[model samples]
Target: MRHFLRPTVALLFAALALLTHRAHPAEHAVVITTTSTLGAAAQAVGGDSVSVETILPPGSCPGHFDLEPAQVRRLLACELFLRHDFQSFLDGRLLANGVARDRIAALPAAGGLCVPDTFVALGRAAAEALAVRLPGETEALRTRAEALAHEAQTRGNTLLARTARLRGKPVAGALHQAAFLRWLGLDVRCVLPGGDDPTPGAVSRALTEIRATGALAIVGNVPSGRRLPSTLASRGPPLVMFDNFPPSPRACRLLGHARPQRRPPARRAPRIAPCRTRSSPSPTSPSATPAGHCWTTSRLRSHAAVSPPCSAPTAPVRPHCCACSTANSHPPPAPAVSSAPIRPHSTGAAARRGVAESA
Candidate 1:
């Protein structure tokens, strides 16, 4: 009984210690990112060791976003700041706000986060930066970063296999979205002009390229395409828009894990009714003229040559070729051809000469 009591007491103390560790964990490093892309990469590598805060909305255009005073101050106070070089607006603001240059880590603006290789590169860069700032968790961050990169590569390969059917399919897309489209194994023939509104000449050129390459669809992005969507949709192939940012950091694993939405079924064109006619005389018959028939003269001639009756109506009247309904009545006779010589009209002097000649 005394030996069993000692073991139970030891077990109780171990459980209490485990709960205590979990309840009061180490403080997380404060990470600030200008965009969700960088924030996602940072979080993916840092995991629970860092608390990531994104300055720009994931859906907004990163280049055009305005940083508020509070956000600027936050950037100054954060343990680390990650960003891309494309946000030139931040250069002046960060300098004026007295934010240390060493605090900010700039990433390249190359391929989108959706690409597996690009995502892996982003993870590695993020891990390196994080490891430098948080030296205590360097090994853990590096390990997680490698795992993340591996997962992205595996998922991307799987996606590539699944999208085998779409490989080499021609597509037109926005310049910014070209990388993602290429990653999806699409053949990007041309890119649209940059900005909200494109010139008519540019639109014409894009249309020409689309026709030449036989593009099945035009891919657009969420940013800077205000009028392009409607214009392209009205004049070109179907437009599909891809998002630039993921909804969450975890969603940045090349592509989100969510199942794709099913496209709506296509609408079929209404079928037309077949034309019907009655039996007619042979082509040799003089009365086989097509003056009253809805069918063309050549068609009537061919029908007369065969001397077979037209097909009978099998459905409602919505004829595509001709509008004439079933004709049970006989066809009208052909006009007579005369061989008489021409004569002058009898009037005035000509009338007197004509009377004399007749007499």
Candidate 2:
């Protein structure tokens, strides 16, 4: 009886320890992301057990965000950290700042889990990692997530439908939101050239090409410099801006509209002409006479011997010294002058004179 009692008491103690380990709150101190999407999922699974904080504020660009020292201190106190794969900037920073690898749970790698799907998967993973069953709210959170996904899909479909009406039209976007635009079946014309905040020259060139190709719209991601859209707006096409990471409800609203906002034309600088030079004709020119004879001081000097008698003008004696004599003898009714400068070597007298003398 003593031996049986000892074995029974040992088994009871072991069982109690297991239950305490499972139910202990600090044993699973979780740091879900501060970003609302992931934070919501953590809450879905953690229920009343875990603490979460989003590292960034609303409307901040995740990629360019910097971490606060207080957030780092909070991260050090956490027992478990869950992050969305490939999208959590804070997760990368935390890991780089000496967070243990095993303490983190990366979401499953599969398509179709864009946002809401991700939230559901995260809840399941977090519950499993903590070695505890999720509270009753797990099913409710899943149902809510599914409903949100359905709503997103419906909105996505509506945008796709509107885009389908205009086939083969070009569209433009900043780098981060290029995929979203392509997913909607719009032809991305030119990527916003160089740097997160595109330069005015780059924007101008892109808009010029877009206008030339008659692109239907310009799409940009949020957290981007306002200058990009403002610059685009001054040009012809309307712009549609979307969110990059942790997409917002406003993105849905913008997607539904699909129509570009009207903006005043961008002011452009005036173009200037290149510098050049021009030469003027000589002051002593030829004068018309009876019988249609004309003589200039330069022409007369070159052909002193064969000059037509200024009075008789007998067929304007062909000036033997220059090729101009032929045109003089058979002058056209109306002569046209070319703007091209006549070179000294190309003159009729220069050609007729002895080569050595001319040179």
Instruction: Using TM-score, give the best candidate's number.
Output: 1
What is the C-alpha lDDT profile of model 2 across 1-359, one tens digit per residue? 99999999999999999899877754345554634345434544444455544454323443454556655666676766655576565566777888777676655524322222333454456456544323433454344434433434454344345346444557766665455445545577766653444576777677787777766666554445445655775676655444332211111111111111111123422111011012111111111000001112211111100112222222222212211111222222211111222222222342324322321
Please state the error at residue 343 of candidate 2 in Å. Answer: 70
Off by over 4 Å in 2: 1-29, 40-51, 84-98, 106-169, 194-200, 245-359
- Highest lDDT: give the candidate number: 1
Worst 10 residues of 1 by lDDT: 298-307
Tens-place lDDT per residue, model 1, 1-359, is: 99999999999999999987654333467887765556666767777777777664323466665566767777777888888767665777897889887777877755754455665677678888887777878888788777766666555565556456677888887777677667767788877777656578767777887788888776666544435754775697765545454322332212323211111123422222222233333211212211101111210111100111223322222211111111122221111111221122212344335323422
For model 1, what is the C-alpha lDDT against the true structure? Answer: 0.53
RMSD of 1: 31.1
TM-score of 2: 0.48
